[model samples]
Target: MFKHFYGDNITEDMAMKFRNAAVALNVQISPAQVQGYLLLRKEDPQASIDDIATITYCK
Candidate 1:
């Protein structure tokens, strides 16, 4: 979970901000998207946010 990497101090507001940002960029932001984002963020740190958005929307 995000707490594992980002630490337990990550507030709900911060999490929501990430969700909002991802959604604003066109990603179909959801709990599943959040999980995928965390995975992809680890595997490909340089991956484009838009790419995530595309995949989320297409799926």
Candidate 2:
């Protein structure tokens, strides 16, 4: 999905930003779980990365 949004050219940097943000939101979360939320950004571009990370905690 990350590849679908960012294109087949998804980069390490792109995925890494989401991975880092997820960890910041929840120290216990795994990269795989974080990647799930990262895919969501493709659906809601209005939200910032921080906002995306906070979604799991907020709701």
TM values, all candidates: 0.38, 0.43
Best by TM-score: 2
- Candidate 2 per-residue lDDT, tens place, 4-55, comes to 4566455666656655665676556555554556565655533435475465
Candidate 2: residue 36 Cα off by (Å): 7.2
Candidate 2 weakest ten by summed lDDT: 44-53
Q: What is the lDDT of candidate 2?
A: 0.54
Can you write out model 1's per-residue Cα lDDT over 1-59, one digit (the tens) per residue? 44454555566665555545566776345666556666656544224333445546432
Model 2, residue pairs in steric clash: none
Scored by lDDT, the top model is 2
For candidate 1, which ten residues in a row score worst on lDDT? Answer: 43-52
